[model samples]
Every structure is written in structure tokens, then in C-alpha cells.
Target: MVIINVLKIVNWFRVTNSADLRKYDFSEELTQMKVMKLLYYVQGLYLKLYDERAFDNDILAWRWGPAIQEVHDKYIGQREIVGEISEQDLADFKEVNSDERLAEIVEAVNEAMGNMSASDLVRKTHEERPWKETEQSDVIADDLIKDFFDKNFKVSRE
Candidate 1:
């Protein structure tokens, strides 16, 4: 049912943005908070553009902002996430890249917010309807996310 594992999404970001393959130069390092926000945006934007969830993981309205619990737990205590890409990660990255639209959504989000500070991203998400409407620690529903993005985010599906 889950279209993609959340870790796979993390891996996609890690592998694609590595020195060998990184297309753009991002000065800020990738922190856990930034990753969490990126995931939130990717899911919401993908739902807006494609009428579906990018990953099935429930994004909760945490104190900081939108967060995937599993991902947060996995990277807890780590300020910077620079893990090596596993074989599975590479394969998953390839699969994600194969889907042109999905890849575009992911890349667009990374380009847009990848260098933003964690606090900036948190403020941005908190301003958004999906995060604002959801109660603290409550799961931000896909419908709310989709509807918010549908009305606010303008993109070309062509």
C-alpha cells in the first residue's frame, strides 16, 4: 500500500546530492530537521501534482513541524546525515528517477528548500494549512495535505 519507503526517499536525497552526482551546490549541510521538512513538501506536492501519496508514512504535526516518526527515530541524535548509500539505496534511487514526474517533484523540492535552515523550514510548514490545522502530534491527513497543495501550489503537470 505504501508507494515508497520513507528511508528510500531519504536515500534518494543522499545519493542524488552526493558530490559525484550533485547537480547544484548547496552550502548548507543536510540536517535531520531539513530532511523532515523536505519529506513533508515532497509528499504534499506529489499529492497535489499526481493525485496520490508519495510515501504512505504518516506525517505528524510535531513541535518543530511536519515529521515522519520512523525517520526521526532513525536519525535521532544525528545533527548531520551523511550516511553512505547502500546497494538497495542506489536501486531505489534508480527506480525513483525512472518516474519522470516523481523525480521532478523531488528535485524541485530539494532545489527550492534544500538549503534553507531547519528553523526556516519549520516556520514555513507551520504557516501552511496542513500543519496549522492538525493538532500537535496528530497525523496530518493526506486529504488535508492534498487539498491545501491543490489550491495553493501551482505547477505544470504537462
Candidate 2:
């Protein structure tokens, strides 16, 4: 089934960039409390996965869904507070943000435009994460995905 096939993918969204994690003015904003709460959730789950050595090597995809998105939803804007795409009309974010999930990223963008303070998993806090950094993966998953198709879904070929 697709569930088993999908399980072969190790999926998790995290902002491993030092710069990206430091954009938020943690000391300057009180509303940051909400963003911090979300980080605790994302990081707490990540620590569990890291300790167990789980979700390694693409075997198990830690879903890039609502969980980490709670933190990621902070950087997006409705009409773009950054002079770029506005969140109110954002469709896909992956094309704009490198190695970032589109769904959650756009949600954050939308919220930012709405004047709601929130952030995505790739926080602007500047902290060390327990799990492996997503940015360190030199190759883009797209090419790998193309290879996956070329080999007819054989995990051994990967």
C-alpha cells in the first residue's frame, strides 16, 4: 500500500539554518511566547525521534504536517511584509524558500500578512537542534525523487 511506500521516506521539517533561526527578536517581543510554545512541541518530538535514532535515512518520514507548522507559521505575510509574495494569495512556498515545506511555510506567510505573530518550524530563534540538520543534505530531494521513479521504486537502488 501507499502507506508502506510512503513510510520509506524520512520526513520531518525543521529550520536548521542558524540565520533563519535567529531572525526573531526573542528578547524584544512578548507575543513570542506563542511561538516559543510551538517550538517546544516541535523540538520535543524531534528529541524523541533523535534519541531513538528513528526516522533515519529516509526509512520513516516524520510527517511534515501540522506539528512543526505551528512554529513555521510565523514568517509568512498576507501581502508580504518583506516586499515579496503575500500570504493571502500564496499557493506554494517551496519554490520561494529553499528546503522549506510549502504548506506550513505559506500558512506562516499568510498569518504574517494578517498581523498575527507566528512562525514556522524553521524558527528565527537561533538554537541548536538535537536531530540531524535538514540543510546538511547536499542533494535536493527532487533529483532523488526522479531517481526513485527511474528505478521503479526499488529501495535497494536508492
- The candidate that wins on TM-score is 1
Candidate 2 structure quality by residue, lDDT tens digits, 48-137: 322221122221112221122222344433222122333322322232333233224323433332232445342322232222222442
Model 1: colliding residue pairs: none
Task: List candidate 2 stretches off by more than 4 Å.
Answer: 1-30, 52-158
| Candidate 1 displacement at residue 120 in angstroms | 1.1
lDDT against the true structure, per candidate, is 0.85, 0.27
Which digits, one per residue and each the tens of the lDDT, describe model 1 over residues 78-127?
Answer: 98775676788799888788877778988899878876788999999989
TM-score of 1: 0.88
Question: What's the true lDDT of residue 117 in model 1?
Answer: 86
